[model samples]
Target: MNAFAPTRTSWRPRSLRWQVMAAVIAINLCAALAALVVIIANARRATEIEMLSSLAIGARFVQETVERIADEQGGTASLAQLPLHINGLRHVRIRIEDAQGNGIDLAPASHDEADGDADEVPDWFTALITVPPAERDIPVVENGRRIGEVRVAGEASDEIAEVWEDMTSLAVLALIVNIAILAALYLVLGRLLRPLKTLSQGLQELEEGRFDHRLPPPAFRELALLAERFNALGAALRLARDDNRRLNERLVQVQDDERRQIASELHDELGPCLFGLRANLESLERMTAYAPVASAAERVATMVDILDRIQGLNRRLLRRIRPMSLGHVPFAAVIADLVADFEAHSAGRRFDFVSEGLAEHYGDSIEITVFRCVQETVTNALRHGGARHISIELRHDAASGMLKMAVSDDGSGMRANALPGLGLIGIEERIGALGGRWHIGSTDPKGTRIDILIPLPPANVQAESAERTVIQ
Candidate 1:
């Protein structure tokens, strides 16, 4: 399995702003729920207390009314009006009953429309807030004769209805306030986090190798410090990249200088020495040819043959060390000669060289890099890839100021898991130093293809003027 693949637990909001907003909303909802629960519990307790208190007061009032009525002359008859006296009492009911079983019941007046809709409070809510029924009995007597009793019972439907209305109003108000808070928070957070988005964009630029990208200071102190650090990092990366490019270019120049020195030494010193040795051997063979000794003549001829082989080997080494004709010949012509040499040595192998829009020369570094890259690629194709057919395409686009080259060979493709060898890595360094790009890939059916694009310097003013003059 891929190590970088995200697992189920790795899931998360893709944006910081949304993540923060979600967290805020969750916290607000939880707090609202907690507050609601507290309000409901407190309302239930307050309603229960109010109902019991009202019933106790009503019972005391009824007891006093009964004793007053019984002391009067028409006390038994006046007991019928006790219900009317207690009719206006809140959260309680009263009833007066005599020995004959006749009674008048009193209840608080219905004000469903004036108070609020009773249906607004559900049955479950009413049941949850309901208090135990409170009741009290007051005896009625006239001249010490038993008569009737007054009963007071607690009632809480009206009280519960009032509490439910207050709760709903508070709930609606809280909802509106929370929505307003969330909206303002969202806007403020977006404004606060906008700098982070800019920082994100700057990081992406860095990833794409645009090291010169910089971030501006944000308003927040923490973000401003972070931006300062980001700018410093970009500056450091840009300086490092420039230094590396210069170092690679210097290294390439040094390598070329060394190769040129070695080639010069071989040509000036070894070439003449090999010639002298061959001359001496040929002269020795001539002197021994006239002798009567056949073994001496055979030895001289073998030595002469060995000397020829040595001279040939030395020439090959010189060619490998440095291309002598590079500066003296056109770049395209030099490449063509290289292909010709390869074909001559490798039997039954084909080499094709194509060129278009190429000038007579580019700078020393550009020329040398291209030559070395081509040389390395071809050698690898023959030695490792076992390629029998190779093709090179060189093109120079003056308008775009780029020199493009593609080298392809029909051979076994590179292995999927194979790492780049030293030669390929060197090519990369060389190309990167020139601010160019190169790609190597396996060809269709078979073989490997390498493509290189190097930016070309602008043409000389004098050369361009002269060409225009000639054209005019």
Candidate 2:
């Protein structure tokens, strides 16, 4: 019941191209993230493999030097010399321990060496190994017994750190590249789909019963063909619309003509007959005033009154079909007659008719249209609106060649959202037939108001027609 709410038609779309584009961007973004994840995992694996291989090579070299030094006689300095000889390595940490797990030397033997007990390696440094080394009991092999374990080790921390930094940098670069590519793709898609968007809007209009909208020619050949087909379809729909409108107009015109003809026949022919019969009956009643049977005369008088009532009903019916003639009557006279008729029929309800602005300079069709609009509006107000008072105003502007008529009532008015019924529909059709505008329904102060505006014929045209009529 709220006045601000619009009527819900069944033809509107819920989403447009912008929504689709956003969805596309989201899908592309997700795909880019997944691809980036896969690349980062592969890069990490490759880096780990390379680091492991490099460390293994360095460990073998250290082990060979340690075993060679052990082969020499009391050559503890040989294993210490291997640290400076291990070239092409950075931040290398080397450890040499004896059979009793006592450190012979540490490559990082300065104050910055990892904190540890005098003979044990730091827990953090040893934890870097993928697996812990096994312990042994025998000093030399005796029937499957082991002597000692030679541990040669290098740290993969720096290399792993370098690979992680490089991987992060590459991921950022890939994301920037993906974003630029997605933006370019989005623009290209938008440009290509622009014609489809226009076509969709046109179709939406057509679905809403606005069949006049035609799609513009598209850039693509196939789409251009589709646009042409749609244009042709719109043209055909317009033609159908015009045909239907003309058909309805013709039907209305025929009905109006039939009503006028019937009213004319009943009024000009049968009306007189009934009046003559009633007059003859009245004459009989008067002539038999002194009859011998007074009861018979009284019955004849009753029949005479009934005949007069029938004649009156027939006359009212004729007026209902077509108003009283205004052929030789001026505009004011016609309005006065109409107001008198309405007042008489309205059972004491007050009705007023007022006029202003060059009432003498009006056309027949304009005058009739205005009068009928007022008459019908007032009748409806009395019948359904429970109106106590009604006003009819007719105004003309001679300078502008505009004529306006308004009928207003203080009554139970119509709702703003309510549509026209049969009476209002007929009024609109008549006004349209005269090439005028018709407005109907409730006023702001709680009443029905029907305003009509019709353009008057140009003075030159009227003068030319008058000259022709004079020549004829």
lDDT by candidate, in order shown: 0.78, 0.63
lDDT of 2 at 95: 50
Tell me the tens digit of each residue's lDDT in model 1 across 96-118. Answer: 78868677565435333423555
Per-residue lDDT for 28-132 in model 2, tens only? 779777865675566446545655565676566665655555455353334345445443443234454444676644444441422222124333432332232
Scored against the true structure, residue 362 in model 1 reaches a CA lDDT of 81
All-Cα superposition RMSD per candidate? 18.7, 20.4
Task: Name the runs in model 2 displaced over 4 angstroms.
Answer: 1-21, 32-52, 67-77, 87-93, 97-151, 196-213, 220-233, 282-472
Each prediction's TM-score against the native?
0.58, 0.44
Which 10-residue window of candidate 2 scores lowest in summed lDDT?
Answer: 463-472
After TM-score superposition, what is the CA distance of residue 320 in candidate 1 from its true location, in Å?
15
